[model samples]
Target: MNARTADKLATGMFWAGALTVIALLLFLIGYILYHGAKVIDWHFLTSPPTNIAAGGGIGPQIFNSFYLLVLSMLITVPIGLLAGIYMAEYAKNGPLVKIIRTCIETLASLPSIVVGLFGLIIFVNMTGWGYSILAGAFALSVINLPFIVRVTEESITGVQKEYKEGSLALGATKWQTIVKVLLPTAFPGLITGFVISAGRIFGEAAALLYTAGMSSPNLNFSRWLPTYPTSPFNPFRPGETLAVHIWKVNSESLIPDVRAVADGSAAVLIIVVLLFNILARWIGRRMQKRMG
Candidate 1:
């Protein structure tokens, strides 16, 4: 074939591939919305689940998801960020750095079900947390830690070396250079990592199941609080996440409109994840503009 013809064909092939991906994504999203829309309402979101009706809302499950998300982020972000900073700034080219990097990569690729099994053994069985919010959060943090570390490390590494050199050349110490210049430049990436981790934690079910048992319609705020001294050590407190609830409704519940409830929960989960991604992208862009 002529070079010109060949080039046109290649370009067309690329466009075709891109369009196919977009079309597939649109189809999946349309299917979910079509099935879920009728069940998405304030009442469905706020009310407790009922065995008699298939249309009962998932208020407790929603709350549990957010609660676990917050707790996991709180535990994972600081430690992961610090590890990243240490690897990028202090341990460059060292054996320790290589080991740390290898560990992070391995953890990132580890199966979610395996992590869940570990949580089941360690947090729920060994430590006696017993399928509570704390146990679930710990499990999620373990899964999220590597993402935060790798993202933070890459973000820090991406900060222009010239900026660090210039800061040091101006009589600034290494710590000052990192804290003032490098960190500010990498803030967008760190935020992006955090958002991604949050989305993952939100959708996670397998790991949570072993650590946080699937229980629904139990939204007692007192059970979640540490201030309640009279609360029992209810580790098997039957905490249900939105994802788990969907699975349960679809697989176990014989309710009449079970399909609608399952689809609606899935849609809500997807929307929440998407919102987090959009917010992260927006924040990253703003940070880039500010840095520029």
Candidate 2:
């Protein structure tokens, strides 16, 4: 075929594929929202799950999900960023670096179920934390770290070399340059990856199942101590995240409106994830503009 004809055909194929993907995503999202949106309301969101009645909410589970998210990100973000910096900026190209990369790649390839089992062994059984939000957060950290590290490292590395050189020429220390210039410039990528990874974490179920347990106590929002079973700060308390709540309601719950509860929770979870993405994108763009 002539060059122009071949190019036209390729463009047409690309459009076809893109359109197909958009259509599929829309259909999936629409189906989920349609079934779940009506069931969600203030009462449903603010109350606890019920046993016999069909009128409970996912209050505790929702809190647990966000609680666990904060805990996991707290562990992942700084550690991941530092590790990434070491790998990309300071680590010499050597066997040790290769080994680190190899291990990271291998960990990234492991399935969530396998990671869950591993978390069960160490975070639950060995650590004696049992099934708790803290354990779940750690499990999630294991699942999320590689992504964060990969993103941070690649983002930092992707920063233009001249930027670093200019900063150095301006009498800035290596650390100063990294902290002030490299990180800010790469903030957009880092934040995007963070939100994407968080979206995955927010929807995670299997790992949390083994680590965080399948039930959350009726938490006392006023209580702020680990000594209290219902305290929000009691990370040791067993808790069910939103994803696990949905899974349990769908599969094993004996509640009258299990399907309804599951649908509502799923919708909430999806919407929360979407909101996180949007928020992150906005922050990333704002940061990018500021940096520029």
Candidate 3:
């Protein structure tokens, strides 16, 4: 084919592929929302699930999901960011750096089931935490830490050198330049990383299966103290997240409304993940505009 014809064909092919992907995503989301919308109500969302009866809600599961997410993020964010910053700015390109990168890549490529087993061994068994929210959060950290670290490092390093030069020229120290200039400029990518991590944390079931347990206790939201056994904020309490609940309902739940419960929980999980993405993007844009 002539050059112009070849270029036109490639462009058409690219457009076709992009449209196919968009169509598939829309169809999947629409299918889930359509089915799940029928059963999602305040009662379903706020009441504890029934063992063998119908009309069970996933109240404790929802609470556990969010609580575990917050806990994992709280643990993951600072450690990941600091490690990424150190890797991007302070680490020398040497043997140690090479080994560290290798390890990170290895961790990122590990299977979720393997991570779950590891968590079962260390966080649950060795630590004697015994299938609790804290154990689950630590497990999620293992799953999410590599992604966040890699993303943060790449985002910061991807910033234009001009910003760093300008900051340094303006009498800013190295740390100040990075903190004030590079991170803000890289906010969008950082936010993307966070959203991706949040989605993974929300949807993860394998790692949490052994760590978080498969049953949530009767949570007492009125209990304000974290030390309380039934308190929502108690990290030591066994918490079955929405993802795990869905899995259990689909696989082995004897409840009569198993299908409805699973569908509703899946829908809520998807909605929450979408909200996290949208809110993170909005916050990132606002921060970037202010920094700019």
- Every candidate's lDDT: 0.83, 0.90, 0.90
* Poorest 10 consecutive residues by lDDT, candidate 1: 227-236
The per-residue C-alpha lDDT of model 1 at residue 109 equals 87
TM-score: the better of candidates 1 and 3: 3
Whole-model lDDT, model 3: 0.90
Q: Write down the TM-score of every candidate.
A: 0.92, 0.96, 0.94
Largest TM-score belongs to which candidate?
2
lDDT (10s digit) by residue, model 2, range 176-247: 999998998998889889988888899999888899999888788888877887897798999999999998
Q: Candidate 3's residue-wise lDDT over 1-292, tens digit each?
A: 9999999999999999999999999998999888999888888888898632564898889889989999999999999999999999999989999999998999899998899999999999999989999999999998899999999999999999999999999999999998899998998889878877997898899999989999877887899799999999999989999999888989996778778888898899889888887887787777778767
How close is each model in CA RMSD to the real structure? 2.5, 1.4, 1.7
**Candidate 1, 20-108: lDDT as tens digits:** 99999999988888888878988789877862266678887898788778888999999999988988888868787778888988888
- 283: Cα error in model 1, Å: 1.0
True-structure lDDT of candidate 2: 0.90
Quote model 2's TM-score. 0.96
Give the clashing residue pairs of candidate 3, or none: none
| Residue 194 lDDT in candidate 3 | 89
